[model samples]
Target chain A: MSLCVLEKVSKTYTTGDLVVYALRQVDLTIDPGEFVAVMGPSGSGKTTLMNILGCLDVPSSGRYALAGKDVTAMDDDELSRMRSEHIGFIFQSFHLLPYATALENVLLPTLYLERPVDGGKSRALELLSLVGLEDRAHFRPNQLSGGQQQRVAIARALMNDPELVLADEPTGALDTTTAAGIMRLLSSLNERGKTIVVVTHDPEVAAYARRVIRMRDGVPTEQPSGRTPRPLTAHPPVTP
Target chain B: MRRFISSLHQALKAVRAFKLRAVFCIASVALGISAITVIVAATEGAYRRAYEMVDRFGPDAMLVLGGSAEARAIGRRDKTITVQDVEALRQAFPTAYLLVPMSSVREVNISYGNRRHQTRVTGTTEGYSRSWSWPVVDGRDLSEADVKGMRNVALIGAQVARELFANTDPIGKFFFVRNVAVRVVGVLEERGTTGAGHNLDDRIVMPITTAMKKLMNEKTYVNAVRIRFLDARNMGRYRQEVRAFLRQRHGLKPGQPDDFRLLSSEEIIRFLVALTGSLVIFIGITGVMALVVAGFVLANLFLLSVSERSGEIGIRRAVGARRRDILFQFLLEAIALTLVGGLLGFVLGVAAGPLLKLAADFPIYFSWKAFAAGLILSMLVGLIFGLQPARRAAAVHPIQAIRSG
Candidate 1:
């Protein structure tokens, strides 16, 4: 079964004397172990699509299924549980809690779990180390640089060992070198059988993904990876 | 329970974020709870003192006075409890009692040669000592012979002795009360004061016979009669019996209230307590208003901060917090804040207790109920005040929070 499947989904909004279509008819599926990129300019419904896919927002019509379970049929709490257990989201600005240390931020998802996570602190520290931030685990967000903060966010995203990790402009605030370094880290995670989805308008960011789906005015078009093949062993592996 | 702890943890974070607002919220609650605590303690203390005075007034004692309550209010003595009534009362009741017929003339000028002092002249029998459970500190009490012979011997109170004799012995001294000369054969026991702040030990006591005949020139009546029964639990029956006997002896028709009034010790305490009850009500309202005002402050601040904290709420929601979790977090913040304030208020009230007692001679009692009330009232305010803001916080959309942030 596919990791995620969206079948003929449409999301609409109504304002005073006007109607807006954020997502028209859309059908998409994501398989496990695939690095998928969702690319679109501003107002192309890419953000809305990612929100619906992340279970933060519901569709106006049609079905969204995750791991054979229907997303639209789930209640708010059920959706919360699904997000906590199976999916991890990374925001463009790296929405890390300003007051919490990097290790505490990574352990945030465990606070909402159905059962207590044993060895949660050690796991958080290990994830921080996986993102090359083991020594910065105790540092607050204000104390960490932009790239380091994003790395802390990535470690947080991987806290519960979620099956699918979604990144919305994961490198939007970073320089080219830092952005490439982040993409390489994500690509390495995809190699280890985690389903990764990267949402961005930058073509350079899309070059790291194995598959790309471009959305224009609420409609999506699929494209294969257009970059020349590169050697995988150029950098050290980030896998745990 | 797990969800509650999680919410509590997050609530602490929220409180830490807005330190000024949190402090103000807590200060208001503390003020309210402290007011309630002090009021409760004061009222409780007043009742305790009132009851103590009543107990001292008499254990199983009832006093029959000479006038109507309304007439006494304006300082008019209607001359009711007479010689006939006293005789009838002595014959009617079981005489295994301390029955004392007494009459008093307040503001009488008593002169001991060069020393002149104004004091109440009370005329009663020797059992005045036993009836009051107040033994004479020096000299001797009034005797039964003194009452029967209508002698001019008297017992001066400690204050009267101090005033009339200065450092000299008041025993064997001659004092004249309004042209009636009396020899001070015994000094009365020193009583400090009544609960009504009347000086108990500033009177000169002579025989009721001498007082009626010699000082006030009255032979037909005595103004007061005091009775002490065996058991206090049977006081209700005693009150009815006394009322019936007095009315029958006084020749009253049916449905006519007796000219003479009867009072029980318990009734006196209850009357005083009822007075304090009004005071408690008045002050209790102010305390409750303080709490309500604090609650309003807390609610207003919470509502104001919700918009600012929406982004935080959104972040939590995206991280898998349920809507109720967000709501619980905010509610817990208010409850916890006020709980702390309540405890602090209780401490403040208790701390102020001794100072109030010293300053105003107030009776301030500390009981667990006051403590519990402080806690329960504070928490209730928090819950009531926090609900709206928590709901608003819980309703924040993650997309909007991210955009706003």
Candidate 2:
């Protein structure tokens, strides 16, 4: 079954005297274990698409189905529940709570889930070990390096054992070496049969995905199965 | 239950993270609570002590004194109370518990060997102790023989015992009053100072006959007549009978004013009690104001905390904390702070009572109700003032807050 399906989804935001279209009649679908990357320029609606797919924002008009459940008309509480149970998110800034330790940060998502995840600490430790940060579990965000903090954020995202993971510019703020490490982590998680959607402006970062989709303005220009795209350095990028 | 405990742990952690701010907030609350409790306890203590003192003067006793504005205006200053007036009141009101004709000789100097002191002297019948509730501590009170034979004898006060005799026993000792030596037959127990700071136990009591015959000389009148009613509630009837007897004995017409003032001990107690009650009310109101100021301090502190931790709140929301959870957490923090302050304040208030007694030279009693009031009031302050800041923290938008950081 398809893990996520969007049918003619659109989103528009009105700011004072201007109306900005964040998404325009977008239709997409992903199978249960596919890895996809969305690439676009600033204000090209890639983040907006990630927000809707992550259940943080609803589409202005269209049907969004996640695992055969229509979530287009769900309220705030229901959306939160859906996010807690079915989706996980990683932000570019590695948004770990500053006051919480690494283990405490990883345990954050489980706190909101209705059902308690068994062996929560053990699972959190396993995720931290997977991200190569088991030794730094007690250190706060300020005590960790940028790369370490991002790894902790990734571990936090997977705490609920979500079916799908949404990462927005996951490696945007890291150095090239650290970025490659994060990309490797995401590729391995995707290889483990988790459906992953990553949004990035960097073609090199998007190169790690198995399937890449490009966006111009608010419209998708390349289909997922069109081709095995060349390396990021060779692609002729277009600005919206 | 685990969730509640975890939430409390998280709240305590948050408070500990900002230790100086938390301490300042709690201290402000504690100061206000302590001030309120001490004032309330002190007022209640003073009122209770004053009531006890008034009861010592005999709750059922009434005093009739010669007084009339119209008579004085007409130059009737010689309308003094006679022994006849006392006999008349006793006969007219057979229900009276006791009747005594009394007079005071203010500031009389009495001497014992080389020691001398100026003291107040009261002369009344042998029933004075029964009517006034003054019990003798040593030897006997003035007997009927002393009164009828007009013998020179005296009942000294506790302070007089300490002053004239030092550590020696005062019973059967001779003390000279205006060079006429009188034997002290009894020493009365101590009565604490009055509201006016007069030492009530620093006086001498002599028989009315001896005082009339020897000191004042050929007296046909007394300064005051004291009557004790069989029942305290019969004060009004007893007072009416005494007024009527005096009016008839003085030969006054129907429209003529009364020649004496009938004052009930109940009235004195009531006046003092009411005055004490008003003072307590005033102090209580000031205490409330101080607690309100403490509440405002707490509110301001919480507001500053909410502003400072906006980013943290957003992160928690992003991790799926509901608005109600955030609100409850902050409210719990506020309540915890105030409750701790209230507990500390109660301890300090209780400890302060004896210290205050030592400083003010008067006994200060503590009331449990006052302590309970302080605690309940502090909790109420936490609820009323803490809600606004808690709501503000809960209302933050996760997306906007995340962007702010």
Per-candidate TM-scores read 0.82, 0.80
A76-168 per-residue lDDT for model 1 (tens digits): 999888888888878778888887889988988888887887999999999999999999988989999888989988888888888889998
Model-by-model DockQ, in order: 0.50, 0.35
- Candidate 2 error regions (>4 Å): A5-21, A24-26, A30-32, A59-76, A110-119, A213-222, A225-240, B57-96, B99-101, B106-119, B143-149, B162-175, B183-187, B190-200, B216-294, B341-364
- Residue-level lDDT of model 2, residues B201-303, one tens digit each, is 8899999998877777747889888887778877777777777878888999999878787777666766666765665576567667777888898899999
For residue B163, model 2's alpha carbon misses the true position, in angstroms, by 4.7
DockQ-based class of model 1:
medium
